[model samples]
Target: MKKIFVLDTNVLLHDPQAIFAFEDNEVIIPAVVLEEIDSKKRLADELGRNARQISRLLDGLRDLGHLHEGIELEGGGVLKVELNHRSFLRVQEMFGEMSNDNRILAVALNYHLEEIEKEAAKQVVLVSKDVLVRVKADVFGLKAQDYLSDRTVEPSDLYSGYINIHVHPSIIDEFYTYRFLSIKSVPGASKLYPNEFVILKDEMGTSKSALLKVSSDGARLEPLFLSNEAVWGITARNAQQRMALELLLNDDIPLVTLSGKAGTGKTLLALAAGLSKVEDEHKYKKLLIARPVVPMGKDIGYLPGEKEEKLRPWMQPIYDNLEFLFDTKKSGDIDKILMGLGSIQVEALTYIRGRSIPGQFIIIDEAQNLSKHEVKTIVSRVGEGSKIILMGDPQQIDHPYLDTVSNGLTYIVERFKNESLSGHMMLEKGERSKLAQLAADLL
Candidate 1:
């Protein structure tokens, strides 16, 4: 049935194109949502960018007809700017508030009553990214739903990039002797992706095993190229880290993604590989690192310093990993080493847009806080001979509209799994410390 979807301000901010997502359903943009968008249009952040995009989209739609009445969208639906002035009267007696949330709720309530009076067989559903808004809509006896059109995959079904198979003892021996195996030799291996890691074990519950990776053609399995190599004084401590290292150090794969919980060494491994490629191997001219600046708690407001000082708090984690890789003992020693090398660059993700990056080993840490559009922008900026690594913990997403499934890191993993130029690995073990791993698991 065709339903009327009342959009909250956050839904539009999260995705300006969300109005066209609901197929053949009428989209109602509350007047308060437009006001909120206007208020945020002046900010110099991703939110402001989205607000401006929404304004441009609405302006483009104005050529069709009056938005106050309705505009016929390209899809088989209508877009209307709902201008109800009911002032939250229906919800005031229950939960009194004149906030935008309540005002949006009033718009939905007024629409519901009009539909009921007209005896229309249609549903009025409030669509929002805010859980509290949905709950309050329920309290007012209205149907509500989360805007989920952007999620690429569910968290449970996220790709792990590797699989284990029980094979005959003879096959393991052949892989060990020849150091290569054909995909036809393994059962149910047709679905494997390029650069995917595989663990072949003896079927008799013995300890004989072989670790291999799918070749670029996806037709054969080869031994891991960097399994025994130490990157920037950090050796792979587990099987998953070894797989990640293989992908990270391989020059053929232009893009690599690593995901794990805190203390799993995702950032550490990426930094190690980047340092080796840029400084040790001279494969890339510079090592560039950046991350999204999503605040965990109440923001510390603005810092009173220059660019480097302003970015110190956000980029300190990256500096710590760099310090470990460079083995700097004293304070400011890492800064001295970086100055001497003249081949390292660190910046915030905000300033990376509109710049084409090339000939650098770029690492984007904490990528789970980026939206799909932001990820596309970053990946599209990579130039020839440049390697871009996206590492993040999907479970530790700080983006309000993004979750494990919808974040940019998981989106890249799912979208580029079949491409030969990209590879992914999920780091399962934490090597930082036992206490940190315990906190990650138990607490």
Candidate 2:
């Protein structure tokens, strides 16, 4: 059945092209949505950029017909600017005044009533990114839903990419003597995938903990740090961490995606692995890092310097990691390391298009801001022998259309999980600081 999706401001703000998403279903944009977009159009950030894009879209649609009269969309759906959804009576009865949110809800309620009266036989679904809006829609007895444009896993079951195996005390001695224990020999140990991580704990209740990698074959369990004979002073805090480490170290699994909230150490971990692999292991030719210069509310156009100078702010995080890794003695020490390493290079994402990168460790930070199409473009640029690490938090995505479930990062995570050549981990803990962790949880 064709559903009448009531467009929310947030839905459009997150994605200006959201109108094209629901196939063969009519999209209703309340008058208030236009008003909201109009108000945001003057701002100067990502939201403003989207707002401007939406305005342009509406204008382009106007070329076809009056939006109020409904414009025929390309995908067999009509886009209508609804002017009749207002209900001052309903508004005063519930929240009072024509508040933007309440007005949107009233629009959905009015549409639902009309659908029932006319017997349109179409579902009236209110789609909003705001949790409160969905809850209010439920309270009002209307069909309300989360936009769900960016999520891969459910709120709880998002893949951690690793499992903990509780094994008999007998396996402990075997793990040390053989240096590589087969997963089958451990009771209850399931066959792990090529890039999977496993933590084996003693069943007899000793603090005996063993972290091992499930090698490409399900048979051999190789100790992770055996290649270096030294620890990096960083250990897995969660099962997800083990998964991340596995991908970071594995030469075969080339595309890796990490998503987490602030202080999750996504950038730190990716940089550490890149440095270790490129500088120490010589697995890759060089380390290359880049980020989208698309600022929160400003265009790449606002910058007034050479490309390198313009990219300095956006690339600061990568440089910070390089500085820390090289233990730079003073300011500008990071630039010295990049020059010394000779192989490691930093550039902007804009330069990435039309360039083939091979045999290098590439880290793209803030990848959540990327659209699905943009991500595909970047990934397709990877040549043989190259590994690309994409790290970003979907929840905090700055792109208007992208969200926790709908952005490119999450898209890659969900789509590539089954591939033996790709791996993903969603970091949950923040290693930055106590206050940062607390803020991430509370706010």
Candidate 3:
């Protein structure tokens, strides 16, 4: 049966094109939701961009028909802006004050009651990204759901970027002897992506094994180009780390992604490889690091300091990893090292847009906070002669509108899996400390 979906302000802000995503169903936008979106149209961030896009979309729809009344959407759905349904007094009696959330709830409640009076068969559902709004809808005995049209992959079914294949014992021996084996030589080697890593073990339970990666041509599997090599005095502590280092140190692959939980060494490994390429080998002109400025909860308001001082708290984790790499004992030693090199630049992801970056090794940390459009903008700005690394923990997302499946990090990993110029690795083991590993596993 066709359904009526009442969208919250956050649903539109998360994806401006959500109106056309419901197919043949009817989409309702309460007037209070538009008020909230209008308030956010002036900020200079991803949210503001989305808000502006939604405004343009609604304005375009005005030419076809009045939004107060229903209009037919291009995708066979009906879109309407519900102006007369803002009965805040009725909402205040059930839930308290007429906040924006409660006002949105009122629209759903009004529609549901009217539907019952008309004996309609269509279901009325409230769609939102806010957990509190969904819970309050339950209090009113209304059906509520999360918007799932843009989700690309589930967290539990996320790609690990590598797999283990059992082969004949001679295949492993031949891989070591010849240093490369045809992909057809493996029994279960069908449909492997380019630059994907593999662990080749013997099917007879022999102790022979090899770590190989699919060639760019997808016709052969070659031994890892780099093995146990130290990058900035940091060696791989496990097999997954070794695979990540291989992908990081390769110049031919321009894009690399790493996903792991806290204490998994994702940031450390990326930073180490970036430093090695920029400082030691002079392969790139500079080492650039940036991350989104997402807050855990409510923001702390404007910061008070110079540019670098204001960014200190947000970039401290990068600085900590750099300090460990340089082995700085003094408090100000990291500053001295960066000054002497004159090639390291750390900035927030806010200023990265509208600029072309070339001849640099770029690392985007905490990338899970970015949206799909935001990540596309960042990657499109990559000029020639540059390598970009996106690393993040999908489980620790701070963006209120994004979850593990819809965030930028997971989106890039899934979209670029088949590309020949990109490689991905999911580091499983935590090499930071024993306590940190235990906390990550149990807590």
Best by lDDT: 3
The digit string of per-residue lDDT tens for model 3 on 1-443 reads 88999999999999999999999999999998899899989876777888999999999999999999999998889999999684667679877787889989999988887787775568899999999999998987899999999988776878888889998898898988999989887888887889998898889998889999999878999988996978899999999999999999999999999999999999999999999999989999999999877832123247888878878899999999999999999998999999898999998887787899999999999988888998998999899999999999988988889998999999999999989999999999999999999999999
**Per-residue lDDT of candidate 2, residues 300-405 (tens digit):** 6567798777778888888886776667789987777677779878887877878999899999999988877678889999988999999898788666455666
Q: Quantify all predictions' global Cα lDDT against the true fold.
A: 0.89, 0.79, 0.90
Give, for candidate 3, the lowest lDDT window spanning 10 residues. Answer: 292-301
For all candidates, the clash counts are: 0, 14, 0
The alpha-carbon lDDT assigned to residue 423 of candidate 2 equals 74
TM-score list, all predictions: 0.94, 0.73, 0.95
Candidate 1 colliding pairs: none
* Residue 322 lDDT in candidate 3: 94
* Model 2 quality (TM-score): 0.73
Ordered list by lDDT, greatest first: 3, 1, 2
Instruction: List model 1 lDDT by residue over 264-311, tens digit each.
Output: 999999988888898889999999999877832223247778878888
User: For residue 78, what is the lDDT in candidate 3?
Assistant: 97
Ranking 1 against 3 by lDDT, winner: 3
Q: Which stretches of candidate 2 lie over 4 Å from their true place?
A: 1-3, 9-107, 118-123, 130-141, 171-192, 217-222, 225-246, 261-264, 280-282, 294-298, 426-443
